[model samples]
Target: MTYVPDPARYDGRMPYRRSGRSGLLLPAISLGMWHNFGGNKPYENSKAMIHKAFDLGITHFDLANNYGPPPGSAEETFGRVLADGLRTHRDELIVSTKAGWQMWDGPYGDLGSRKYLIASLDQSLKRMGLDYVDVFYSHRPDPDTPLEETMGALDAIVRQGKALYVGISSYSAEQTREAARILKQLGTPCLIHQPSYSMFDRWIERPAQAGAPVLTEVLGEEGIGSIAFCPLAQGLLTSRYLDGIPADSRAAAIDNPFLTADKVEVRLAQVRALNGIAAARGQSLAQMALAWALQTVTSVIIGASRVEQIVENVGAVERLEFSADELAKIEAVLKG
Candidate 1:
């Protein structure tokens, strides 16, 4: 059977926000390919999720060179989906991919060196079966490499028509400021910054300068948009752990190093407290967590393994507004 997308995919079902001071607009909730689209997962399931996301007005799909369990497989999977289902509507999508982590073995295969970034993006484009991505990101800052060199490579990629825009991820405020300045000088302003932000991870809210604002505020000042990852804190903010970690959950998976039992235990109390406030707001814990993150950033990247999860997560956009007392209660819980 042939797959045709819903005719009304963009019929005001989702909201879009300007990416920083740029003309580009991203969905309030973008789909991330950080997990669940790899070779280890079912292709048909991944395809279904992608189609559902698009049908729901999730125009942006985020990817990275090192996203898969066997790195690079997610792009390969997404490439097949693009060619099979999304080829005709490419213009309506904002596809993004990143480079800058350890992608391959050799000396030139990692970091922010010009050689690595260029080669990595070339591979990423090939894997995704696209001539150009809407946005290409330096996955992280390379302390060993000059910021000018990395930003210059990004500018060059845009000039070569391989990427329409350039961005950075996991970079500190100072590094972001410097990179944005360099990109601006080269006539290619930084489009967005991908940072790990959530109620559980509030590093972005911490003051980066003695008397200045936080990193998110700094990005606003630099005219760079922010898309927060881990907005659910790896399921901690959701009801997934309310009754204790399930054997099938990420925290209970032995291979998952990012989320462990000890960490969940440490934050369980806070999570429960926030859940109470979420109940008062007439939203689920996951929804409130996403709404909280989007309250500050331009958008939030959500990873879903199933179509139902995507449906539930996108509903967060409906209840984004919070009362002053609700906000105060959330702060009190976090500060506890």
Candidate 2:
């Protein structure tokens, strides 16, 4: 049976923050339906995960038109859940979807072209059974397409009331600054930038003397929101890699080109050290990684394969803030 949220259901632990300079705000621990809500997954389990997230006060749900292994199946499945379970709370939800990579086989299936962006958004809306998305993002920068054209399409999407706000993902500091400028000029300032960040990954701390400030600083200065994905370094921050890689873990399940068995061994050392730090603070490694992200960025977008994982993730927000010494030690562990 499908489950609907209780009218009095609420969890006060998770926090919310404004999206950059925009009036829209998102939950501190937003959930991403990128991995587990796919075609081959169980419908009941996906529904339970979504319900559990809502119960934990995760009001934001991030999705994409091409998330499933077969592509577009995730949105379709989420549509089923929305239609059956969460439709009553639609107004209380912040739903977002993006389109950039590739989804189908055709000239109009990928990239940041105006045609592709608009078409993908339409398909995404249809699959989610929604009239408008809270946030529609250009999934990635289209180096081949002019930034103006791409941002123009995003602005148009907002103007048409198809998306309340626009965002960009996987963009560098330079690209994020340029996109923010174009969007601001168009009167629809880019709302947020989603990048991959974690304790094991510190790309955001690049030397500012070499170029402009890091993207996180740029977004904070430009008044654009910053939400990090893969905050657990694709589950490396969790205890799953502490002993060894389980067959069900993301690195073992998918053919990750970046995270090999050897890299897991290297990251295991980091995880062990970081785990010591988390234990010192009386938090799990997962909580420490998540709290580290929330302490660093405006929001941290997390993905979960089960309801229990979502429950554990929200606990990070209870003690989201950390101390100077903790941050210093985290930096040291990251450097090692």
Candidate 3:
């Protein structure tokens, strides 16, 4: 069967925002191929989610060199989807991938060194079956590698036509400034930043200054757009654990250390308190969290497990604005 996308995809169903001072206006919500698009996961489900996301006007699909359980499987999954239906609409999509974490075993396979960054991207392009990605990111700052060497690799990736633009992920405010300066000298200005942000995690919202050098402040001065990952705090901000954790929930998965059952119990009170506010706003806790996240980030990457989840999450765009009273109340709960 031929997959036909919704013609009304761009019909005001979604909103776009400028990424800092860049010309790119990304969907307020993008899709991240982090957990569910792995080789061990069902192929049909991953393909369905990607199609549904595109039909909802989400042009950006985020990936990384080491996204799958076995590593490199997510890119392969995405490449299969592209060939299945999205190949013709390539120009309408913004596919991005990253490196800088432990990808392969051995000395030259990880970190932000020139060898790792370049090799990782080249391997990523091959896995995704692409000549170039719309955006390429250094997954994290390399403390062991020279800042110039890492940023220079990014600059070279752009000049060599392997990436249309460059970005950084999980970099601190101070690190961002230094990298931006190096990239500027290399004639490739930083385009965006990918960070973890949610109501439970507000590190990026700190006051920006030379002494502190908060991320939000540095990005403003550097003219870089930001996309937040884990905006739902690994499902902590959602109603998933309101009544208690499900048997199959991420928190219950023993292999996933990012979230734990004990941690969920600790935050259950705060989650319920926040859920009440979402109810008053006539939205689900997940939707409200997505809207609130857009308050700081140019875009929030929605990590979904199924097509129904994508459908529900995209509705957050319909009620993105929150009144002053609402903001204050939400703050009170978060602080409490």
The regions of model 3 sitting more than 4 angstroms off are: 207-210
Candidate 1 global CA lDDT score: 0.92
The residue-by-residue lDDT of candidate 3 on 265-293, one tens digit each, is 98999999999999999999999999999
Model 1, position 308, has a per-residue lDDT of: 90
What value does the lDDT take at residue 278 in candidate 3? Answer: 95
TM-score to native of every candidate shown: 0.98, 0.95, 0.98
Query: Residue 59 lDDT in model 3?
Result: 95
**Model 2 regions lying over 4 Å from their true place:** 6-11, 207-209
Q: Candidate order by lDDT, highest to lowest?
A: 3, 1, 2
Full-model lDDT, candidate 2: 0.87
> Quick one: ranking by TM-score, best first?
3, 1, 2
Q: List the residue pairs that clash in candidate 1.
A: none
**Per-residue lDDT for 63-106 in model 1, tens only?**
99988867999999999998896888899999999998888998
Query: Stretches of candidate 1 above 4 Å error?
Result: 208-213
Give the Å shift of residue 73 in candidate 1.
Answer: 0.5
The true-versus-predicted C-alpha distance at residue 238 of model 2, in Å, is 0.3
**RMSD of each predicted structure:** 1.1, 1.6, 1.2
